[model samples]
Target: MEKVINAALCFDGNETQKTEWLDAIFSDVDRHYGYSNSFEKAIETTAGLMPQAFLNRVFQGTEEQQNRRSFFIRHGGIRRSPLSKIDVTDLIAWCQQRNTPEIWGLVASGIMLWEKADANENGYFLTTSAVTFLEAAPDPEPVLHAYADRVTPSGWTGSRADTMQPRADAIAELSLHVRQDISDAARSTSNRLAMEIERERIRDRQRDEDREQRFE
Candidate 1:
């Protein structure tokens, strides 16, 4: 069976309602391409794309897990912070329209749980109430603030003054460079996957032709 799986977001509802939503989502997905047995299986298939080290951090409940989850959200173009109020119904609608992979939803749900738990070191329970709130709330707006308005020291005055400005500039430059690099890498990976998919289609077509010729 193909390893990849897709899932839709679940919104606020009672146990029966939630189960019905999930069932509908799964049934729709299966109608297109039958592979996944349940939402958990779909999520696991999505998680399988990550490096083992990253998966380790996620499962270990370490601070690194938060960073990784944040990275996924950012890279996936989910601009709003998980800490902000999110409308679950809108999110589910968006995911269904886009056919978003289940993995992204899993990461997002994890981030919500993390934020709700107040970054508790021990980890938070994934209660049904929390999931309901996540799905039922309205989509959050971007939190905009002017950087210049924030309080800061006028200038460096100590012995470190000479190097501080240059160091800061270099760090800022490197941050931009790293971001560009990541974008390029993601694009390259996407292109490669597309090529592989096309090749598979060509092979399937060729196999069908061969079978038809043999019968002739």
Candidate 2:
């Protein structure tokens, strides 16, 4: 069977909720968290990794597992959805509505999770209830924080031209570094294995030579 990657995330309150929900569905080591910039990225990344996997509104696997998994959410409210539970189809529909490749890429590969911030009169702080899902997502990009570069940073305007290209370049450099590290590790492993094989071959040769000398 094909493997599915399911990512997860939620506000602190709903932390227990998403975990329980996903555990019921995936029920394996295939589940992970904190992989992306946001909950959306986690969901998107999960879905993007497996475009062909059928994501149903309700998991039809096993009730025994569901009840067992629900133990994690004993303190939190049940993570239930009112609308048709968002699945791969919902993500595809979301992308279809936007009609943009960029957005589609995100919906297709992004693993998004977030809660709705509570609000009331007098501007009182409210509970943050976030939805979590493991859908597809856009590809990873370099992070460029203008505030990090600013000599004196203040609140964000959210309207500035993003210097994402430079950030992307930096990420590319970092990716190269990661690739080099992986290559080095692979080479080291191969060398160790080869050395062992060569050592065994030399021992076998020595044994054969000794036996021949004894016969002479």
TM-score of each: 0.20, 0.19
| Candidate 1: tens digits of C-alpha lDDT, residues 87-154 | 34434444444443543334344333322234543223333433443333232111000111111123
Best of the candidates, TM-score? 1
Candidate 2 minimal-lDDT segment of 10 residues: 125-134
lDDT of 2 by residue, 90-122 (tens): 655654555554443223222222222234321
Alpha-carbon lDDT of model 1: 0.34
* Model 2 Cα shift for residue 11 (angstroms): 36
Q: Which segments of model 2 are wrong by more than 4 Å?
A: 1-178
lDDT of model 1, residue 157: 45
Q: Could you report the Cα RMSD, in angstroms, for every candidate shown?
A: 22.5, 23.0
| Model 1 worst lDDT window (10 residues) | 141-150
